[model samples]
Target: MTSNTEVFPVLETKRLVLREITKKDANSILDYLSDAEVMKYYGLDPFNSLDNALDEIAWYQSIYSNKTGIRWGITLKEQGVVIGSCGFHNTVSQHSRTEIGFELSKGQWGKGIAAEAVEAIINYGFKHMHLQRIEALIEPPNLSSQRLVEKIGFVREGLLRNYEFTRGKFDDLYMYSLLKQDLDKINSM
Candidate 1:
């Protein structure tokens, strides 16, 4: 495996392009992130302004620069506008592991776009980031996210009761993971 820190990796799927998000995309990011329905199970309150979106984009850049994580803006091939974002965070190189997070605009949900984009990044994590395990933390109420990860081969490890404080309360989360060996098994099948 090779690690090149200079170039931001851009990923592509059948219908989407996963690329670095610029300040120009803040409005698009705001559109979905501000929606209470989109933020319901996301652990954070909906974004209230463009600055919130800018701050988010900055966090993405900070993670990449610190070599701790990477996030990609999800855009349709035909539209070139960010509808959402997805990627890994809480990366621990020593442990060969990382946590995945993602969100999509309401219009894009149920279109399999999340699955396709997530699968691309999972492969990248294993083959390029040299990760042994990728994890997803899902709120119990987020059934769609749970299903998305399971469909991509992540197994539900267990429920961590009140594991995190979010949205003004402690929330229960289900931990799910996909190991490199697990992906190998999936690919061979």
Candidate 2:
């Protein structure tokens, strides 16, 4: 587990590099954040300008500095450009838990990139961070995200009705969770 004292960790999988988000990534951030299809389920509307992406990178940095969370740019090794982002949205150290969030460029959809990035983070969370659990929240309409979580071993934990207001309306969400114990079991196999 990374402590507040440690610098942001960079994680890597077979085809992706998960590194700390930076202002340099603003253009890449816009590659997905500005897309209607990509931002459809996100809490905010699609970014309309480069400044929005810059602000987003700053926000991500602030959370990392505040020790509240950390996000990584999901860069494909072959492309050498970030196609998405993923990381802990909240790290409740007291509970040894964190909530995971992720998004990818629509152009990269159906390529299993999300799954690879997420699995690397989950492994890092459990093995390095000593985290006990990882949680995910997804809008009910996002079947692909639901499938991604389930494929990563998250257990459906029911719904939170009108859990969040996003894109001008209250949206229902489903909660899913994965425990370290379960991960251990899977790994031992």
Off by over 4 Å in 1: 1-5, 185-189
TM-score of 1: 0.95
Q: Judge candidate 1 against the unseen true structure and give its global Cα lDDT, from 0 to 1.
A: 0.90
lDDT of each: 0.90, 0.86
Tens digits of per-residue lDDT, candidate 2, 42-146, equal 898899889999898887887787777788889988666889998886889899999999999998999999988988888988998789989999988899999
State in Å the error of residue 79, model 2: 3.7
Q: How accurate is candidate 2 locally (lDDT)?
A: 0.86
Q: How many steric overlaps does candidate 1 have?
A: 0
> What TM-score does each of the candidates earn?
0.95, 0.93
User: Mind giving the per-residue lDDT tens digits that candidate 1 earns over 1-189?
Assistant: 114358888999889999998899999999999999999988778999999999999889888887889999999998999998999999999999999999999999999999888998998899999999999999988999998888778899999999999878999999999999888644542
Q: Return the lDDT, model 2, position 166.
A: 76
Give the Å shift of residue 103 in candidate 2: 0.6
